[model samples]
Target: MTADSEISEQPIEPATDVRPVDSEVVLARGHLHPAILLLRLLDAMRQSVVTVVAGLALGLPWLLAIAAGMFLLQLGYALARYLTLEYRLTATELRVREGLLHRQERRIPLDRIQDLGFESTILRRALGLTVVLVETASGSGVEARLDALSRSHADHLREVLLEARREIVAAQQAEDDAITGPGTADASAADNSTATASTAADEPEWLVHRSTSKELFLRGLTDLRLSAFVVTGFALFEMADYLGFLTQMSGVARGVRDWFAQFDPVVLGLLLLVLLLVVISFGVITGTVGNLVQFHGFQLTLRGSVLHRRFGLLTTRQKTLPRDRIQRVTIEQPWLRRATGYGVVKADSAGGSRAQGEDTAGGWDVVVPLTRLENAFALLPALLPGLEREHLPWQRGSRRLVMRTTIVGVLIGLAGAAALWSTAGSLALLALLTIPIWALLGILAFRNLAYALGDRFLALQHGIVGRYIAYLPTAKIQSVVVRQSPVEQLLGLAELTVHVAGGSPTRLPDLTIENALELRGELARIAAIAAARDWQTRANATATRPPADRVGESQLDPAAPPAGDRRPWTEPRGDGPAADEDHDRPGGAPPDSSRPL
Candidate 1:
C-alpha cells in the first residue's frame, strides 16, 4: 500500500447514537473432540456397508442371506468402534482430545481462523453432528468437530468463536495503540471489526451488509464450474452404482433382456450392452440427482444486516460469510441454465473458504451454492452499489463452435461405427448413439466457451457447475492477459486470463480481438490508477521495453528509459517521461510482479 493510501485510511468508528450494545462475553470453547473422527470414519464405513447391502439386494436369495449376515457383522464392529471412540472439547480451541489408550490432540486457535463453516449431510444431520470446520490460510488449520452434540453445544461453540475473536482483536488494538500513538477511534473500530471474525458481528449492526435469497442464489449459480460438476457427478454415479441400482434396473429392462435372449448372441454381447447402459445411466442420474439435492431447499436470510443462508435436506447448514471477503463477484448463464433463466453467482475471497468447501477445512468460501436461476443481479448493490450483469463479449461464436464440432464429431463417429459394424453387430448402434454424444459435447464446448463479468472487481463468469468463483482483491492481482493462440487467432478471438493471488486463474475465452484488447488496455490503465502501492505505480510508470536485439525484458518497450533509474512499480512521477529505459536491465522485459490477485 502506498503512503498516501495508508494515510488516507481514516480512523473508523461506529456512531453510538443508536441502541445499547449486547454484552460481550469471553466464552470457552473445547478442543476438537475425538468423537468427530470416529464419526467421519463411521460415515465412510457406512458408505461401504451401503455398497454391500445394495450388492446383496441384487443377488440371488441365498446370496442375499449371506450378505445380511456379513452386514450384521460389519454393523456390530461399527457400533463397537463408535462406543469405544473418545473425544472432548475445551474453551480456547478444539482438543481432538481420541483413541482408547494412545491419544492425540490437535489444537486450533479460534483467533487465527478465517472461516468457521458448518456441514451436515442427510445422515450426519440425523446423527446430530454439525461438522465444525475451523479454517485458516496457514497450514495450521483444524476441524474441531463435536458430532451428535446437542443444539446447545453447537450454539455454545459458535459463541466461543466470537468471544475468542473479540479477545484477540481487543488485545491487538491495545498493542497497536501503544506503538502507533492511539490514532483514531475509527481505526480502532476497524481493527476490532476485522478481529471479530466477520464484519457483521464486529461492526455495528447498521454498518453490516446483507444479501437476500435471490442474491444468494445468483451468487451460487454463477460460480458453477463444469470440471467440478463433472467430477462430482461422476463420483455420485459411482456411489450410486455401488448401490447396485443398475442391476435391478437391468432386471426391469426386460425388453432389452428378451431381445438379447432371442438373438442367441454371445454372452459378451449382453455384457457390453448392459455396460453401455450403465455408463449412460450414471451420467444422467449423477447430473440430475446432484443438482436436485444441492440446489434444493436453499434459502437466504438476513440478520442484523448480515446475509446468511440455511440450506441442506436432512441436516440444515447455516452460514454467514461476510461480503467484504468477496474481492470479485461474477454471474453466469450456461445454455441449459440460461434456458431455465437460472444464473449462478460467485465471489472471490482472498484467503477465505471455498464455496461448498470440503468437510475438513474452509467448509465453504462460497456464500451461495446452487442458488436458483432467475436472479443474478438482484443482490449486487449489497457490496458494490452499481455492478450489473453483462453478457459475455463472445457469446455468439458459441453457436458456430457448437454446430461445427457437432458435425465433425458425428462424421467421425459414423465412420468409426461403419468400420466396427462388420466386426461386431452391436457396433452399428454407435452411429445412432454418437449423435447425442457429439451434440452434448457441442453444447458443452459452446456453453463453456464464452465468458464475461468484468468491472471494478475483475469478475469472470465461466464454468458449467459445480461452479467456482476465484475472488481476489484488485490490489492482490498480479497481472492480466489478453493473448491469442493460433486457434483463437484463426477464429478472430482472444482469451483473457486474469492473474490472481494463490495461482487460481480465471479465463474468459473466445472474446473478440477488439473487445479483449479494449479490456486489456482498460485494465492496464486501471492498474495504474487504482494501485495504492507506491512502488508498484513507479515500476509501471518506468517500465521499459526489451532491447531491439534481445527477446528479454530489455526488448519489451525499447522506447522507454533504462529500468535501473526508474522507481518501483507504484511510485508516481509528475515529470518523468511516459516510461524510462535508463534503468532497464539490458535483458529482462519482466513487468513489475503485481501481487497475484
Candidate 2:
C-alpha cells in the first residue's frame, strides 16, 4: 500500500493549519462508506455465478480455480479502492484522488458540473448507502462516480456542491458585468439579490409536477409497444436455452400444438384469438408493473435555477439539472397518448450520451414522463423562460410537399404489387387498395409538419400517427445545413437540418428551396451571434481569474466561427440562392422578428 492509503485508512485527526477568512477552504473530505466493500464483493459474486456453476457441473478443477482466483483479485481491488479513494470538496472544485501505484487525481470545477445524480439499488438502500454520479459538459456520460456513500453524506455533498456552483456562477456573472460596463449591472444586482433572499429565507422548492398511481398506470398503458413484448419473449427463450431447459420447453410447446390441432378449425381460430388476447393482457400488466417500480413517487421541483427530480421504488434516484445547461425540450405524443390527451416532455442538455433507449430505462432526460398535453406544453416555460406554445407563429411547408409525398406513396404501392404479381397472380390487385391509405397518411403528415422561429428558440413539429414538437434554443445550435435529394431538387423542395450538442440533429423536411436557404442563413447568423456573446462572457470571466488559472481565447469559445467566415450565409453557393436575390419574395421573406427572451 502507498503512504497516502496508509494515512487515509487511519482515524481522522484535527487540522493544524490556520487559514485566512477569504481564502479557499476545504468544505468536505472523505472516503467512500465501508459498505462499498461488501457491495463490490456481492456484485463480483453475482457476475461469476454462471462461471462457477458451469465449473462445478463440468467437474473442471482448473476452471473452478480460475474463477476463485478472479474473485479474489476483484475483492483485493475493491479493498484497495475503498482504502485509497478519497474525495475532497474545495471552494472552487471537487477533487478525487485514488490509486496506490499510479497515483491519480481528478479536479472538476464546480461551475462546469452539469448535474449531480444519486442512485441506490435494493442492496445499497438496505445498507443506507447511495451512489453519487457527477456529470459535466464533456459530451460524455457520467464523469465521476462515488459508489456507496452513506445516504446522509451523499445528500449533504449534493447540497454543498450545488451551493458552491451557484456562488461561482454568480461571481462570474458579476465580473462579466463589471468588464462589459454598467449596462447589465442592475439586472445582475437584481438576480444576486433574489438569490441572496432565497438563501436567507431557506425557501422550500416549488413543486412543478408529481405522478400519482393512476397517472403512472396510464403512462405505462400508453407507452406499450408490441416490440417490447416481442423482445421479452425472445429473451425468455434465450434464458431458457442458457439454463438447459430448451428441450423440455420445446416438447411442451409441441404437445400443446398437437392438442390444438385436434380441435375444430373454427374453434382453433377462436382459441388462437383468445391466446393473443391473453398475451396482450399479460404484456400490459407487466408493463404497468415495470412502470410502477421505475417511477413510483415521482416528483419534480424547482429551486431557483436548478430542477430536482426524485423517483423510483426498488431503485430510487435523485437528480439535479441546471436550467442553463438544457439545449432543447421535446414534447412527444404517441398515437395512443395523443388519443388519451397525454404527452411526454424530455430535455437534452449540453453533455452526456444520446441513447434514448437507456434514457427510457433509467428515466433520464425526461422532464415530465407523462402528463396531459396542455399541461406538458405549460411546463415548457419553466424549463426555457418566455416560451409560450400558443404564441408561436408556426410556418407550414409548400403545398407541393403533400403532392410529392402522395406520389411517392403511390409509387411504393405499385412497386409492392409488381413484386407480388408472380407469387399471388390476380390477388396482387389488392395492393392498390393501400394507395388511399397512403395518400391520407401523406396529408396528415403535411398537416402535422411545421416550424417556428422565435427570438430565442427554433421549434419544429412533425409526425403522422405520433407527433413530436422540439424546442431548440437558438443559442445552442451548433450547425445548420440545407440538403436536397435528386427527387427533391426536381420538385424544388429541400430539407433544413439543425444540429445541437448532445442530441440528434433536428430536421425540417419538405421545405421549399427558397425557404430552406433563408432559414439556414438566418439560423447560421443566430448561432454566430450567440457564439460571439459567449466569447465575450468567457473573456470577461477569464480577466477576473488569476493569470495562472487563465485559458487561451480559442479554448474559451471553441464554437466561434472562423475568422472571415462570419458572412458565409450571405455568400452564394453554386446552383443555390443568389446573393443579390430580393428578400421581399414570398418564400424568401424573413421570419417575424421578436424580442429576445
Candidate 3:
C-alpha cells in the first residue's frame, strides 16, 4: 500500500482536520416514505375526476370506463414507483434510482447542483413530510425530486448536499492556490476569494423580513386582477346557466331570458353592461381573497449566501436560492400597487421552478412580495450587491417609441371598429371614438419606456398598466443585439436587446442608431471582460486540479472550449469604419445579436 493509504488507516491526531474528503465517503441510502403512495393516489383521484368530467361532456360511456381504468393504472404505477424509489448522496454525486420494469437511474454531480427548493402541502405538512426539488444550472425545470421525505431527512439531505458543495469549492480553491501561487492570483479572483473567506469566518449576516397580517391583507386588496376575476365569474355563470338548462330546473334562468326578451335592444345592452359591472365587483372580491391566501405570512430570510422564502396558508412553501446563482433582479409595480407605493421584488437564478401555486412565480423568485417602494430599494442592494453603485440614471426612450406604440394601438382600434360595425350597425363609428382611449394607453406605454447602463450592469423599464424594471450585471449577459426595421430606419431609431443568463432578454426599443450601437459596444465589452475574468479564474483553478474533477469543462457542457481565439473585448474594432459595420452585412461587424426585422 502507498504511504498515504497506510497513514489513512491510522487514527488521526485531534489537531488534524477531521473533515472527510469527498471521494472517501459514501452516503447512506434513502427511501421514499410510504406516504408518497397515498399522495400519488390523491393526485390520481383529482386527475380521474377531471377526466370523467371531460369524458361525460362528450356523452361517451367508453370514456368513463377509460377514465376509471386510467385512474386504477395510475394508482398501481404510483405504488410501484414508491416501492422502487431510492436516493443516495456520495461525496461527489447525488444518485437517484427508480422505475420497476424499465429501471432508471441518475447520478448528478454535487458541483452541478444549482439550488434546492422545499415544499409541503397541507396534507403533507400534517404528515411531517416535505418534497425537495433539485435543480441544476441547465435553466430548465427541476431536474430531480425527492418526494415524500420525512421533514427531518429532507433537512438533513439539504444540509449535507450544501456542505458537500462548499467542500468541493474549497478543494478547487486550494488547487488553484497551488498552481497560481498563494496571494499572486488575478486581482478580481483575489477579491472574490477574500470576500468568500471573510464571509465564512465572520458572524452570519442574517436578516428576516416578515409580512404582517394587516399588510398581507392590504396586499391582496390592492392586487386587483379585475379582468381575471371578470373572466372567472363569467365562466362560473355560464356553467351554472348550462347546468340549469340541462336539468330543466332553473327558474332564475327562465325569468332572466323572459326579461331580456321584453327589453328593447338598447335597454338590453344597458342591462348587460350593468351585469358586467356586478360580475367585475364579485371578481375583485374573489381575487382579493385569493391574494390573501397565497401570500399570507410571507417571510423572506437571508442567512449568509442563501436566501430563504416561506409563505402560504393552506400550502406552506420554502425555497432556497444562493446569491451567487442569481442572474437578474426585477422590481415591478402594477397601477394599483403603484398608487399604494408598493413594489414586488423578484430575483431570477440559474435553475429551479418557483414554489407551486405561488402566483408571483413569473420565471423568478419573489424576494419581497409586497413592500413599500423604499423597502424594495433597501432590499435590492442585499440581493444584488454588485450593482449597488453601478446603475446609471434611467433615461427615457425617443419619441419614436410613442409614435410606434400609437400606430399599433390605432391598428387594433380599426380592427375593433370593423368588428363593431358588422355587429352593431350604426354604432360602428364608436370604434373611431375608441382611438383616443387607445392612444392614451399608447402614451402611457411610451412614458414608461426607459433604459439605463452602468459600469457593470444594464437595466430597462417598460410596461403600460404594470411596470417592470429589470437589471443584471453586464458580465452575466449572454449576448447583445441591435436591430432596425425599415420604418425605424427611416425614423433613425433602433431596438436593442440584452440577453442575460436564465431570464428573458431585456429589450430597449426606440433609441437613436448612434445610441443603440454605442450601448451595444459598451455592453459587449463589459460582457467580454466578465467572461474573460471568469475564464481566467477557471484556467487558474483547474491548472492543478485532478482530471477526475473536470473543473475546466462548463457546467452545462462537459467539453472544453476551443483555445487561442482572440478576446472579443480586447480587439481594436472599436475605431473607424469597422465600428459602423452592420453585423447583417457580410465582412462587416462580427456576428452580434443584430438581425433585420
The most accurate candidate by lDDT is: 2
> Candidate 2 overall Cα lDDT vs. reference?
0.67
Question: Which ranges of candidate 3 are over 4 A from the true structure?
Answer: 1-24, 49-68, 137-141, 183-205, 225-258, 261-274, 354-364, 406-439, 542-597
Best by the TM-score measure: 2
Q: Give the poorly placed runs of model 1, Cα more than 4 Å off.
A: 1-104, 121-129, 137-148, 181-296, 301-307, 348-374, 383-455, 459-473, 489-492, 502-504, 511-518, 521-597
lDDT of 1 at 332: 44
Q: After superposition, how far is residue 192 of candidate 1 from its true place, in Å?
A: 6.8
lDDT of model 1, residue 536: 26
TM-score, every prediction: 0.52, 0.77, 0.74
lDDT of each: 0.45, 0.67, 0.63
Ranking by TM-score: 2, 3, 1
- Residue 45 error, candidate 2, Å: 1.3
RMSD of each: 15.6, 13.0, 12.4
By lDDT: ranked, best first: 2, 3, 1
The regions of model 2 sitting more than 4 angstroms off are 1-25, 137-141, 162-178, 183-204, 226-258, 353-359, 417-434, 543-597
Pairs in clash, predicted candidate 3: none
Better candidate number, 2 or 3, judged by lDDT: 2
For model 2, how does the per-residue alpha-carbon lDDT over 166-192 read when each residue is reduced to its tens digit?
A: 676566546555644553333333334
The ten-residue window of minimal lDDT in model 2 covers 545-554
